[model samples]
Target: MNKTFQYVSYLWDEQKAKSLGDDQVALLIYRSNILGADLRITNYGGGNTSCKTIEKDPLTGKDVEVMWVKGSGGDIGTLTKSGLAALYVDKLRALEGIYRGIAHEDEMVGLFNHCIYDLDSKAPSIDTPLHSFLPFKHIDHLHPDAAIAIAASKDGEKITAELFEGQIAWVPWQRPGFDLGLQLRNALDANPGIRGIMLGGHGLFTWGDTAYECYINSLEVIEKASAFLATNYGKKRPIFGGEKIKSLVGSQRKEQAARIAPLLRGLASSYSRMVGTFNDSDTVLQFINSHDLSKLAPMGTSCPDHFLRTKIAPLVLDIPASQDLSDLGAVKSHIEKLFADYRDGYKKYYETHKRHNSPALRDPNPVVILWPGVGMFSYAKDKQTSRVASEFYINAINVMRGAEAVSEYVSLPLQEAFDIEYWLLEEAKLQRMPKEKALSRKVALITGSAGGIGKAIADKLAEEGACVVLTDIDEDRLANARKDFGKDAAIAVKLDVLDNDTIGQAYKAACLAFGGVDIIVNCAGLAISKPLAETTEADWDLLNDVLVKGQFKVSQAGVSILRTQGLGGDIVNIVSKNALVSGPNNVGYGTAKAAQIHMSRLLAAELGPDKIRVNVVNPDAVIEGSKIWEGKWAEGRAKAYGVTVEELPAFYAKRTLLNEIISTKDIANGVLAFVGGLLGKSTGNILNVDGGVAAAFVR
Candidate 1:
């Protein structure tokens, strides 16, 4: 009947638990999902949960106690049964007999594989020992911002003692490993009936005799810590002192962010190409515009999870927030200077602390960049990683806000941070990752992507690992077009190529969502079939406007973004076989196609110096899955050929040498053939996907 505390609440669904019945692991998963669902409780993949249960031993045909814990690289929020690693509880505890000290902590991680009770279990993580050595049956080790705020504060232990009054225990800073596990065990032994323990500058560890009880315990601890921070909220100016710079008003911040993101993206990708994500949320702006930003940012983050993802600290650009950043060249020059210094500082940091056996120096570029007024920009190998990196820094910002509001925010010391960053085990994990996709770091913008050949082209590029920007004049159609891709994969924008402003706006959206464009696809077009005598002025204008002018505007905008990124790019134009073959009732459409073909060749020649390749794809008789064939274009073409609409596929096929009908998917494969790395060195070439239309062949 009584709620435990304010600032956070419990979320135990009794009916949901009843449905799960007596399955312990299912209950554990239910609990983990609920805890990870709230950012106030934990962030994506920030924590691990485990529960001890009785399982039938596969080899011995006997029941034994086992521990099912979240495995490596798995997110608690989206975890499945396969993501759980089942280990022998008795075998895990037995490792203490041959236990080595802190220096040999990494060996403990290797030993976890030996304790695997299930042959199909996922690989164990470094936190395995921490969960196993604990005395309770169910444990929740979480990086909740509220609890970490107290844990990461300088006076954390004292603050926790005064608030919890021995109901919780505090252990000083230590990396998560075998030694930390032993320390957690010792603290629980000393405190007897204490419900939880706080790991200084790290996170919280709460346990219960059962799965549901463990969930409630974690909720209670986090809620109390949050309420305490709120009560201390009377210490006004909950920033790093106060605002030192004036943040840009309204949309100005994002406009500046959009313009500046590509420049920063290019700079960040110097060592290896990367995708970027930008954030200007109020929390980010507050930190960026604060007076103590310069002082506090350099201290870095305290949580190891934050430290690993963001590195030691971010490169904070100290521009007066109100200063006009519209001139990209000016902004680039200023940032270039700051970037060089940051690179030098990073190299110095590595050299200062690195041991002889440390792994080789990594890319000196910063993962996180703080822009006053413009907010935060984070870069990584791809969109999802870049996006998650930004979120981690935001988590750090919240941690800092709470800690600074109560006590000085303290980060992990430099030596400890370095040890974890370059550890041999961490290096091994990095080396074990799979090879990158052909277009892994590339971003593509495809026009007319609502359906048919345009949609097919977008899917092809995305399949090869490129982030896609789906644009079409029909906004409603664009929504359905983008439904299949995740936020990190594709974004839909209403773009009418006739309007140069809409063209510019779409490029801006791509730059904001995926750093910049690396591939431009001109697939948006229409067809008209009428004799010269029957063709009206409006028909001629419509064909040329949508085909000729549209390709120019879209390609021109794409070339600008590619130039800004300084990364070589590809532009694929989907022309028609009619561009080369002269057929009756195709005068306006054929002329527009011819212009598009020649323009590709001309632009290919001009843009070669910029490392931009332009290629043309000619698709013929692609009636299936094409929006163009759904209306007058198909009817008009059918009438001109003296055949019913249903007979067009066979009629067109009979005209070709191969007598094979083409589908929209075949056209998509043609686009992929051009953009995929197999043609990395070829450009200005036209490939015909028309089943051998000899008249349309290139001479």
Candidate 2:
């Protein structure tokens, strides 16, 4: 903590607010963005804000006071006016009277629904009651890490009071509900001059007559908390020494993570079908490498806000400091037992805290895993959730570190964690998420994904919600592709498919990035047209290396990992129509592709018993954006067809019965259909993506 607000990035504009109608709601959205822009203030959908405004009631035709609060599941960082739910203030206040006898969460949700002022508004946040009960015109509640550090300490209340000099009230941990709302109101009534309230084991709330005042109030409190933490904990360091864990430190650690991720993924799938995203970031590595990791990690999250995402505690994998991670079979057995024990412990925790009306026990698998030698692994239904959990854990580590520096770090009671985890309002967010796409929890590996058909196939897989590992010899192009697809959805690895070492490394990286591969699209190839008599040995070797042997190596690596996970998978080889139909002066290219097609058929037969489907997609004349159709190759192909280079595309399309121009996207669609199990029971089959080329048809 710098004395000043070093991290605040509020870019609020008065004219922009005026442009949006210059009302309390506009100001609310503006301030929310300001507060949400910094992860230190609020992380991914973790905070809420509200404003008291007047809106016309359709039923009574009169202006009535309404509370416009952040809607459920809305992230303030990207929130809009429509993301705020409007509720009748009077009706909401009346709920305090009737909500006393009702303890059921469903009943409370229904009552909150009945208080909605606008039918078209989104569902109000579960914390709406606290904002509604407050007397201020504007209110903001955030779970800033700095505030959580102080609020989650052993003597959190005392530390909070000393830090803010009693300018803020401290409320003990209470599950969010109507009763907690009343308690907040009572605290405000008792401490009328307090500018803010720090909710123990939860978050902070500040309010004022205007949105700017409340926003500034939140910033001031966070700054003071940051200062206190820096003064006390700035020099503290982890107890572990780098030399003591040399084998488990630096670059080798990532290799260890890669080896263990697939094993953990397999174990997790035993509980559910959720995918695990392995993160070996500097933050995670530092935390996991600490000698006190077992002690700190089991101590629960820094705040209860993370419970919904990361659960009460992380599952700690028992990887010995000097263990030989190279022995994968032994490592797998060790991790299996660790996972089983973790599940048992989780069951015990649930048994101790569960209530009569609690929802059925969630999958006992931990959302976050702490493997000492490796790094943190976050598991969820898909990549997005796993990334969110990873972020929360990283922030929690920082907060816990700060708290430990000052004093002993403590978390909320396990009971409170369970309450929030099972809360109907919290559960509603998961329920409201749109149905997962066909390939939502799948991971795909696409070679030569820097551009052309491989790039298109990678994009399509990501669009369908698959975590994609993009591999290409073109490092710059692969980096750009990763940036375009985002870090959460895509990972880039420089892979020369022809090299056995690179193929093996790429497979390991894919497993490390996203559990293991569910689909492998072999789209790496080169076009070399030469007559059988003139084709040099170099051309034959190049074609065979990239087209035939490369596919086999990649498939073998992927299949080994897939078999270890024991999950059914898909393998789609991007062969060519030339594989079936010969063209003059194309011996080298056609021979290699034909060999790959036959290899795919053999692989399909061999891997069928393991539930892995192998198929081929033959795409012809995909000229647009195809690197194969460049320079002398395109001119020569045009000359062969008795047409100019400009007419080559139209010439090929006319030769097909469909008379349609084929594209890389068309080939990508064929790969997607095969990998998506459109032909689940059909293997050793070829799907044509050549606009219905009669000669290439493989009936």
Candidate 3:
């Protein structure tokens, strides 16, 4: 149960599972997590595992068997006890008596709820019957690329028979439901001593007497398939029948990817707004550059799990690496034409395969797109989904490679694929998905993001479901601030808005990280307080550079990307109340703030034609967490007001019309009001987050 092989790692620690003692469900979770850890075993959320145990029935006060399987939409790698669905084993068996036949198998799914052993258990998955009907105490069902490579080959059934030599049986593709579960039970009955089944055009199923045995059985089968594929793969010359168009160099590869990412993201979001993930690993490049890419790509993925993540097939752009990318006009035109054709093709596919009971046609856009030399692009509702979709396609590529090396690769027949895609059950699961966040699929970039107000805005946007780019001149704080956000939610860049190169580089990073930016919060600034008599040339230049010039360059950069996406966007500038109020000892800082205010109005007027909204938030006397208040500005302001620095918060509050102290979060909320689709219609306007000093009120 705990032996290692040259192919797959044996991750099960005997002490770990044994430590659980009598907790059989905990043991299953331990086994499932280890198996799901390896991509060679299964892609994210692609596999499920189960165990059966005897527990006293609350009503009968007698010991009864209960089957615990992974719950609907749960990921094995991250599964918890709450994520497993528990049903009475005997109740599951009783359903067979009422089951009409294969035609009525779907109705059995509804019947599964009646078999619940515990009222609080998670909702059952469709594969419940397969695990319940099986005689084994422990079972693992997985869609490992290595095994699917063998299962999806043209001679898969023949090869499975020859390789395992009666140790394993083959089950032709069948939709996972009560009917397939019955078939699995029948297979076990016929094979007598067989350990597992190679599910044709799908995946593998392995069973054992216990959790440890089941874990080992799953690994052993996958390892053998992997070793066989590796050996056959090396013997075969020039994988995928040699390379066609060469892969672009690393620099050119990323350059091209970043350049086309926005356009492609916009095109892919035709059906609905979607986030995108790009991958250019060596594995991806090899497949993308292969000679048989054109021939094999259109054949699509074989595994149902892969098909669900990726669409019927990826849209392959035949642009060679040698093609000129300097002028994007021609490239854009060609891309548009291909997109039109792809939509038409997808509609026809739906028309040809749809049945009377089929669910309505969903998004016709391709989930994946193959750009040779540029890498793979996958789109979905959010970053994680897009990233997971990309991983699934890479698994599909591995499946295609192994199948072609050993035997001709074959995808699931289109009819079978349509049946699963349009299945009412699948549609129901889709309907059950949680509603997306207001800012979901939108990406935001905030300058001085490591600073107080900037960080607040960054966190707020990310919380509202937008991917965020945190840019700051403070390298240490920038790095540390990003730690608070999830990997899929944020990226940090050390950007100095004074430098045009850094300004452009930040946008490039933002595009590469999250496809492109939809919200730009210009919050980078430093304050200076100097009387006319004491103000120096250097003071004037510094305030102008960081405040007025900095915001201008950053806003200019963000607008370029937003325009390219052709999607209306929001630009929120964090200015100061000093711009509207005339105060002693604030000549330089106030002038810079005035410039920022007018500039926002200018840009808002110009960019309105492009459907881009530019607004401003003016904050005043914010002492806590303000980088400006940490230096000479606070000392000067305190000296000017004849009050101690410690009393600044109270002093600012007392002067306000409402006598309220504004925090960094308050400023963040002001920015959100503009970009969060609340006050989205109003632009070239200002929202004051200050305590409402009468002198600063706009007339």
Candidate 4:
């Protein structure tokens, strides 16, 4: 172990402990956070921890020993006391005897559930027995990549001994269950002096009398594995392809990804519905573009923990280094065959490992797909999961590289991987998650999304679980808007609605970012409220270009991508009440908006055969959070109404039957009602979001 890698202790601070109230629980959370904060120790939800403590039993008014293990679905890094489920120690320990005859995995889960001390507490982690069975006050189990690299090696046992000098016990890979728990318990009993246990093909387990001790032990073991890998394997820089490969793949990798991602996404959709995000960074590109990727990638995941996120193996698309990626038809045909082959391979893997009670076959779509010319694409139902799978697979590449540098990289046996994949406990963790949001797995693209009604719509769509693409002419504001939504929920693109090329590029970016968009919100517009006689040809052209032509171009681009994906989609245009009821002197703005409404109807009629729906929202006076009604436009409108600027908002509100001012959020809600399928089977409809503007209501 590297003795010099200092471990910072957060539990020793009295003030911090005082705030949490329970010193022991505070210490446990502190240490768990420490483990989670470091990707080298654990990534996301890859590990579990536990602490044995004495707490007063509210019913009996007596102190009782309880095992507070990490609750199901809890990530150690951000875990709190509430995230830990407490089980009565004596009752949980008694299960060891009862579990002897219980071979069925489902029965074991029932038993674990029955042992929960608090009725309201979360289900305990499956490894609860592994911790309870061990005679330790504090325990930490993690799937650290370094430890996994050593554990998944051909001579893992020998390497473990050399690195830890018999300080840790080695248990052969066992499917995590009652039997595996027993094996772990018996192994520790025989090696009573060991500080930790390394499960072959799995991960590391360490325990101590205190949180700091257990944490440090985990750190020491990981440091030892890292040091061993560094000393034995030595670092090998990935081979960036030669000029030939680079020239063939194209000098612009990002542009190549944009072009190729849609084909891959479309192909993947044939097997199952999923969204894909592209990765073409230096590290990912270096790994994917390597000559030896074909030999290295199929070996398997770095550890069994990855089986749930990333499938057992990635699907490698064989794009010839000499081929051009610009040919969409060729790329599409190749991807179709690759997806079919990958699905067939997965089915065969399942058939070979099928058991009488094995879980149902999972979606056969590949989570990780490696394209030679265009880096990697990770697919999931949502952007977050796709990104997570990408991270895991990228790390897998590094782990495999390190292991191969020293020795052959060996993953768990196929059956073991299958066991983890089908384990009832892991399945339960997924089942325990909250119901999917209304727009879960859906992708939305909003135009003019930098601020106001457009941004509101973007926020609402994302809140409903849709990955959004926000576009605007204001690049800085668009970037800031994307940042506000975070990378997981939104991506930004600078777009001029009037430019056909930019509109097409934005559609491609959406496809590259999230498979393909399911919803298109056209909110970009220009307002010029002038008398018909005063309106100039240039004024009419500008409004027509931005409000009518721009929207038409965006819709055209969006529908093309949607058609290629073969998935039904929705288009909601943010028009104005002026379209329904013409206001005096607003010739250009009203005429263009009226054209948009008519265009949407035409589009709906044409696209209904493809299951595409087109709808329009007519908002009257959205003064607050409305960029359209600001500065000169607001002043002109107020003057036209013969009212002060401050009174203009009130005047418009009082004109409505509801006598209420409309907000951007109100308009967004109306759009959501249509696009989110609340008005199912209804298309070519106009939703009036003008706070009860009766004249604007669709007749």
Task: Tell me the TM-score of each prediction against the true structure.
Answer: 0.97, 0.92, 0.98, 0.92
lDDT of each: 0.88, 0.82, 0.88, 0.80
Worst lDDT run of 10 residues, candidate 2, spans: 238-247
Best by lDDT: 3
Q: Model 2 compared with the native: what TM-score?
A: 0.92
Winner by TM-score between candidate 3 and candidate 2: 3
Model 2, stretches more than 4 Å misplaced?
1-3, 6-21, 59-61, 102-106, 234-247, 280-286
Q: Stretches of candidate 4 above 4 Å error?
A: 1-22, 234-251, 321-325, 500-505
Regions of candidate 1 where Cα sits further than 4 Å from its true position:
1-6, 234-238
Which prediction has more favorable lDDT, 1 or 3? 3
- Residue pairs with clashing backbones, model 1: none
- Candidate 3 versus truth, CA RMSD in Å, comes to 1.5
Candidate 3: where is the Cα deviation over 4 Å? Answer: none
Residue by residue across 264-376, what tens digits does model 2's lDDT show?
77788876666777777776776777766767788788576687799888988766755675657877777778778988998998899888867778899888988765678
lDDT of 3 at 583: 89
What's the true lDDT of residue 478 in model 4? Answer: 88
**Model 1 agreement with the true structure over 1-699: per-residue lDDT tens digits:** 335546555677899999999898898898898888887888788899999998889889899989999998788887878999999988998999888788888888889899999888988988888898886889999998988999999889999998999989999999888888889999989988998999998899999988888988898889889888888753765567878778888678777777777888888888988898988899898888888788889999988888788888999876665567566776678888888998999999999999898999998899999988778999999998888888889989989989999988898889999998998888877886788888888888999999989998888888889899999998999999899887789999999999998998998898888888888999998887888999999999999999999999899878877888887889999999999999889999999999999999999999989889999999998887777888888888999999999999999999999999988788888888888889988789899999999999899
Of candidates 4 and 3, the better by TM-score: 3
Q: Report residue 596 deviation for candidate 4 (angstroms).
A: 1.3
In model 4, the clashing pairs are none
